[model samples]
Target: MNRPVRTGTDPDEARARILEVAEQHFRRIGYHKTPVADIASELGMSPANVYRFFPSRDAINESICGRVLNEVAEIALAIACTNAPAVEKLDQLLTALHQHNKMTLVKEKHMHDLIAAATQENWSIIKAHTERTVTIFEAIIRAGIEAGEFEVEDAAEAARAVRSAFMQFFHPVLIEHCVQHSEDIEADLRDQIRFILKALRKRGSLEHHRQDQDSQPIHG
Candidate 1:
């Protein structure tokens, strides 16, 4: 005879299953409206049993949102590898930023309401992920400058520029503006990508380098 499934399955397995179910629930119904019982029913467990595995609903929500954000950042960093052209990487970064933030809203709306909680309790995860993205782009910028394809000064600052541009693109207030005006953010982003890259490149620095090289005495 087939047996009934049990609660508190391996902790890791149970958490993963909970997150998978929560993603759908949060997407279908906003976070506040998605009760622990709803997720438990979907997973074929009693509400108390689910709680044994996850102490609180907000905790479960944070785990699922963190997982999705990491996946999106990994994909963006992979496509931003040095083998890709700067322009190509820029476009990938912009696309990833837009899609990631959009999905982040849908998946973790509760986290927004609980921002103070997360900032106090979970800020390290946030800082670590942001640092990871900055480091990845810094590597790409340094590589491009060495290759002579890009004339960039201060890879650190350049990385920050890319990060800041994306920040603006994904800013919540600006997102509301975009929704209200129905502006084509994608089209605007493409235009802004060029401006971002141009600003990052060492404009006058490159010209000065060229002048110095031309002035060098020939050693025949």
Candidate 2:
């Protein structure tokens, strides 16, 4: 008699399941304290089996961190696609990104710590995420240039500069430090954005200047 074959879980599904369970544990227990064994046990699998999907705990953390970064990227893309003027879009995008990072630090400290460590370690995922964010900035800058809103000669270079200048607001580690030190982050963020906009605006663009002056201050 022929015997029925036992089917194993799909590799991709298993990997995703492992990430889900690991993230839950990272949230409940701290990221540094959550062991692969705990994740495996919760998933009803052996630690070795989990290892088959992710070579090490750090590898799993990298995947989870990537997902978190991707959410920020999505928010940027959504703002970029809006019909609003490029200048306004850039303002909103930067503010939204900063607020998202701050929210993560307040609500998900463990996940924030994981990403901060990844940033300090110069992880590949961090590099990739930075590139993605810079690309979004470049696109917005290009649109602004086309609309005579910005006088920058090179969108790509300007985008990189913007990213560097806003590091304190965007970087997880720096954001946390600002929060801990009670350094009036919102005021600083607004000042930084205004400075960047001034640098990007065309000479004597009174209309944009007036619009910026009239616009309500960004909150959060």
Each candidate structure's count of clashing pairs? 0, 0
Q: What is the Å distance of residue 186 in model 1 from its true position? A: 3.3
Q: Give candidate 2's error at residue 125 in angstroms.
A: 0.3
Q: List CA RMSD, all candidates.
A: 9.4, 4.3
* Superposition TM-score, candidate 1 onto the true structure: 0.71
TM-score of 2: 0.92
The digit string of per-residue lDDT tens for model 1 on 1-220 reads 2112354357777777777777777666656678887787877778887777777876776776566558767787778764766544665676667655655545555543333244346655566767887887787777778766567668888888888876656654455355446566655655566567666655654455335434543221
User: What is candidate 2's lDDT per residue for 77-189, written digit by digit as tens?
Assistant: 99999999888899889999999999999998888988899999999999999999999999999999999999999999999999998998989988988888856878888
Candidate 1 backbone clash number: 0
Q: What TM-score goes with each of the models?
A: 0.71, 0.92
Which 10 residues in a row give candidate 2 its minimum summed lDDT? 1-10
Q: Estimate the overall C-alpha local distance difference test score of candidate 2.
A: 0.86
Native-structure RMSD, model 2: 4.3
Model 1 segments more than 4 A misplaced: 1-5, 99-125, 182-184, 202-220
